[model samples]
Structures are given as structure tokens and as C-alpha cells.
Target: MADIEPYENALDAIPGAHPYPRTSRYHDAEIGIHRQADGTEVRYAKRRLLPPIEDRTGDDTQSHTVRTGERPDLLGRRYFGDPGQWWQIADANPVLDPRELTDEPGREIDVPLAGHFPRSPQGDRRG
Candidate 1:
């Protein structure tokens, strides 16, 4: 705690740091900061919000039965054609970690239509 710096300077100081990829679940989330009473600033990415599973029904989503050795990235590749978009499947189901989606064989998981980024029905992003 010898030095106190502005929040923006944190990430800016990192040389050649790459931003999150488009396929990342965090692609749309903006950086955020929290200021402490003592003047320290903590920077972080805002939480990426996902709607409840019930809202994803119909044309926007379908179902897939998880198989042995199946993984979210592989599922993303097969369905969305981009292995990095696995977060889409994570959001569609009720799991904090995408790995849980494929934890059991024969488990049914939600698969959104390709490129169907789930936004609130009202078309707003609160995150």
C-alpha cells in the first residue's frame, strides 16, 4: 500500500495486454472500479448478466443432450461454429461454471440459436 494510483492507470500500465476476445463471455462487459474510504481504487470487470433459463425458450434456443467427454467449447464449435462462444451455453443453463453443463452424460442443456446473444426481453443490458 505504498502507492495509490488512479483506477484507469491499473490496466493502462500493463504493456501489450490483450483485451478479452469476442468469444469471451466478458466481451461486452465494461471495466468498473470501486473506491475505498481510504482512497484505494479497485478495478474489475462488470458482471455479465444472463437472463433466467425460462426466458430462453422457443426459436431462440433448442436443447442438446450432453454426451460423455462433451465440453462447452466443443459444443460451441459444433453449434455456434466458434469454440470460444461456449459462454452462450453456460448462460442458457443454470450453472455458474460452464463445465457443469457437461458434467453428466444424457443431461439436456439449452443451446441458443447460432449468434443468438441473449439480451433481456426488453432489449437492455443492465450489466
Candidate 2:
């Protein structure tokens, strides 16, 4: 298993992005390192490409309509009882960018059923 040192570094370099799940395959991915003319090094992780939403199973019971000013994390907390599981809602929906999933009011989003998320090594919940 790969450690999260590099991923943590990459998260520190990015703004407005949360840390990758500890059990996620991308958690161990190599971040690009570039050296500036002044000899400063910058570390960054490549944009993570999510699998197609078609790959996810549909559950009519978990479907939700985008309300005004709602976000994925809020929905995750409402449906799954965990705000950190926002990615499950993001992944189950067609939008690649989570922000787009809730960007417009009245848009419908598909939320994955409970237990649809990957489990951490310690059996903790993750997104």
C-alpha cells in the first residue's frame, strides 16, 4: 500500500480541493514536480478523471432534486449521514465537476445508495 505523503503535499499545493480518500488509488499517485527559474519546486497532482456516471448503479429512492444553494456535501450528509461522502453523490451523478452537479437549481442528481462507497482499510467511510 502506498502512503499519502505525496498526496498530502499535492493537496497543500492546490486550493479549494479536499484531500483524496486515504484508501483511494489516487492517494498514492505521483504528483508532478516542476522547478522554477529561481530554483523553487512546485508540486501538483494531475486532475483526477472520474469514471463515467453510467458506470454507477441507479437507485430511484436515492434520487434528489437540486435545491437552490445546495451542495454535494450537504446532500451527502442528508442522505448518507456523512458530509465527507460527497464524492459518492458526485460520482453517481453525470457531472464530472461536483460544482456543476449543484450549480443550477432544479437539476436532478442521482445519489448512490448507502454502502455504495468504497471502504477504508479500517472500515471507515470515505468519499
> Which candidate tops TM-score?
1
Question: What is the alpha-carbon lDDT for the whole of candidate 1?
Answer: 0.72
Q: Cα miss at 19, model 1 (Å)?
A: 4.8
Please write out the lDDT profile of model 2 over residues 1-127, one tens digit for every residue. Answer: 2433576556656764644544343553445789999999988865555545554555433667899989877887888677776876776666758888889999877776665543323333223
Question: How high is each candidate's TM-score?
Answer: 0.67, 0.50
> Clashing residue pairs, candidate 2?
none
After superposing candidate 1 on the true structure, give the runs of residues whose Cα lies further than 4 Å from its correct spot: 1-19, 35-42, 120-127
**Cα-based lDDT for every prediction:** 0.72, 0.63
Off by over 4 Å in 2: 1-30, 59-61, 66-70, 96-107, 114-127
